[model samples]
Target chain A: MKLYDYILSGNCYKIRLFLSFLDINYETVPVDYYPGREHRFPDFLEINPLGQLPVLVDDEVKLRDAQAILIYLASKYDTSGRWYPRNPEAMGKIAMWLSFAGTEIMNSSNARLHDMLAYDLDADKARANAHAAFRILDDHLVEVGFAGQEWIAGTQPSIADVACFPYVALSRDGGIEHDDYPAIQSWLTRIQSLPRFIDMPGIHFMK
Target chain B: MSINFNKYHWFAFYASQQIMPAEIRARSMWNTDIAVWREENGSIHAWKNRCPHRGMRLSYGFIRGSQLVCLYHGWNYEGATAQCSYIPAQPNLKGPKTACVRDFACFEKHGLVWISTVAEAEKEPDFSDFGEAEQTIHFCRSIFVNESPGLVGEILKTSIFIPYGNDLADGAKLKIETSQAEHHQTGANYQAIWQSGRDKKKKTELTCQTEVRNNAILVNHYKDDQGNEGSLIFALLPIDDKKTGVHVLFSGDFSSQSLTSAKRHYAKWAKRMRWSIENRNLQTDSFNPWI
Candidate 1:
């Protein structure tokens, strides 16, 4: 499988973490985002007319969307509640959160940042947007921590952890702090110790 | 099911569309006083759990065409009026078409039956392809941050970063270079990248211009514009480590292709930056605690 990827994006990081955790081997295809031409190129468009990065084109099919990609991988791979499990109730729980991740974290965190960062709004709104997501997670963390256990869903780590691994860790990039969140802190400690654990991609200090 | 209050009162919850099969028929929570059932021919009827005169849970009643007769009383209730008919005690009296407990709305689809109190229905909720195609295989896990629905939608709309930790995992004390929000004019587009154990924003002068393909989704955020609240869209894209790598494109083109990629590509991307996601579960990860 070849991945059209950007190092700094957290959305793409979700998938990257899962692959490494599962021990899957693949090559990363770098799109020349700097020149801005590669993405619009006909060849690249042919693979994914959507023009999204982290486009995974493999022998069987071509796919896009981090959440969708995560679903496909966890489903195809056989794991006893390892990455993707087969239980009905358990599946629902995981689905609910994954949906939340796609809608809530992905949108509010970055949108708030864009409001300030892109000059759409003032700094207050950007921080407010970041805080909005923070409160949502803090409320959820009051109890039933990590699906009632060390992992996100079920008894062990699954794609749920992989899918959410990035934004959960590095929200501070948008100036959202994590010191106030104790359960979040605890949860972070647990996931950080994973065997194939990796750090976040750095910010563009000198764009 | 139908609910009965005092004085022959009638109450029904829209069960489904009134065309559901027997298997998914009882997904209604209509007060639980009466049982709703479908006759063999496909018409619906509500009967008391007991014979109108007797007291059986009409749900156990048998369906004979449009009329439902109590199993024990053998007293039939007409579907048209929900009125009692052919009562053994009052054999000669004709029953009203409304003698039977009437069937209401409610059915199963979007995972469960969603019933409304008002009669006559409007359009159903648009369950997007996003809802149908994706499945969260892991556990409920936790909420990352306390984000509102609209704001979260915006984040999704803007950009999704896959934290690629190839070097960072190896203990690279990569100084999280910081910068201020450029606050550019003309709807400026940019990506905010964060480093682990580091909290600061950095500005980088782009050496080149490029396209950042974004996700098709639009975040639905509501804010007070004037005296009223309004909505705006936050578009998103998925970025990979290879091109936008912590090792490489710390500053690079953000695109929509990142939002739409194969599962393998996303999985690979997830693999690269997972340590961070796991570590940074947001503050709003939870929902309705202490329930």
Candidate 2:
């Protein structure tokens, strides 16, 4: 599998983390996204006309969108039921949450982070959206305690936790403080303590 | 040669969407013009959708015991393969293929009946994805002429599938039964038939144009000029739907505090897919017809 990225993308980092956890072997194809670079080239369009990050290529299969790749890997390789699990009820529980990450967090939170990193920080709107998202989590953590006793989906650390971890884990870099939600904070600590956990790949890995 | 994918190529097709249910093609099981019927025993038999002697669609035909008698001709067809069992003048010729109309290929799964698009067929269609925990909804099928299945997989953001099963276990369950674990056999309960064909005038198969609106992508699976099938179905895993949280430990939304200028490209891909489908070859790498 070939992973295309700019190195610092937290979205890309998510792929790397899962790959490391499963120990699935793959090759990384780094795409240059600087002014008028790899994205606009004819070759890239042939690969993914949509032109997005973290494209996982396995022979004839090319996965461009992050969320799709996350599902593909988890569904394809996980036999342990520890990562991507099976069972109808557990399946529904996981599906609804993953959808939330796409429809909500990525659009509201990650979009703001991407904008801020681009240098035009809409601090006020970003801050408001951040708080709005936080409130939802605050209530949720209260509904279901945040202790490491059980991972996001009740028992195991699943793609649900993987899907939500990165952006929120690095929210501080984008100027959103993490002090407000103690439950969320403790949950973060628990995730960090996992056995095969790896650090978020930083900007320098691009070269 | 123009590939019609209709009666000429595929006689029938079936898809067992991982997150969805198995589907059947009941439209083409006609004998001349009469439709087929099954007895209470779950046996499937076909006939002309219409009676040859008069012309009433067999869909309107009545089933008594194991026989399907056309309401118009009062003609009786064989209960098993739907051969004409009785014709006022042809009683002696009884239930033979010569006295029959059309008998299409019918296959079954789970608890449903499936007709084929072709005569000579081999290999069960790939459906390993149904066992995967991922979300796969076979809503409206749109075929881009000659587009590869893997390419189709890449286009999907939240839902997709690869043609090869190399990425997944051949069977649904993975068990360690012996030292040679590779030889251990496992299983997944897959059903091809389930007595669930909804009756409607609009052809069940359709096609439509998809677009990117606001920031969300909308795929409209409405009908087109040619007769086809289309509809929108979303298959995704569960996650928190709430958009806001009260604090850090409580949420995971990213915030940008840095003054450094960051450029984020806003992209929403939208395109209209045509819905002229002929043979839905379960074994196809290209969902489109092959000329």
Number of the top DockQ candidate: 1
Can you write out model 2's per-residue Cα lDDT over A1-207, one digit (the tens) per residue?
788875666778878878887888887778886544686788888877877676888777878777788889988887776777778876776776677555555534454455545635566676667655654554354334412234566677888777777766666556564433444554565576676677863211110
List candidate 1 segments past 4 Å from native. Answer: A34-37, A40-42, A108-127, A146-148, A202-207, B1-291
lDDT for each of the candidates? 0.45, 0.44
Q: Give the per-residue lDDT digits (tens) of candidate 1, residues B124-145.
A: 4332321113422111111222
lDDT of 2: 0.44
Task: Please give the distance, in angstroms, between residue A53's alpha carbon in candidate 2 and its true position after superposition.
Answer: 0.9
Tens-place lDDT per residue, model 1, A55-163, is 8767887898887788887777646446777778778878877876776666444643454345354555546655566555554543344224556666677777666
Candidate 2 lDDT tens digits, B55-166: 6556444566666666566787766655777876666765455656566665544222334435664444333333223423321111121232222322222211111111
RMSD for each model, in Å, please?
26.2, 29.2
Q: For candidate 2, give the lDDT of residue A52.
A: 62
TM-score against native, each model? 0.39, 0.39
What docking tier does model 2 reach? Answer: incorrect
Instruction: List A-chain TM-scores for all predictions.
Output: 0.81, 0.84
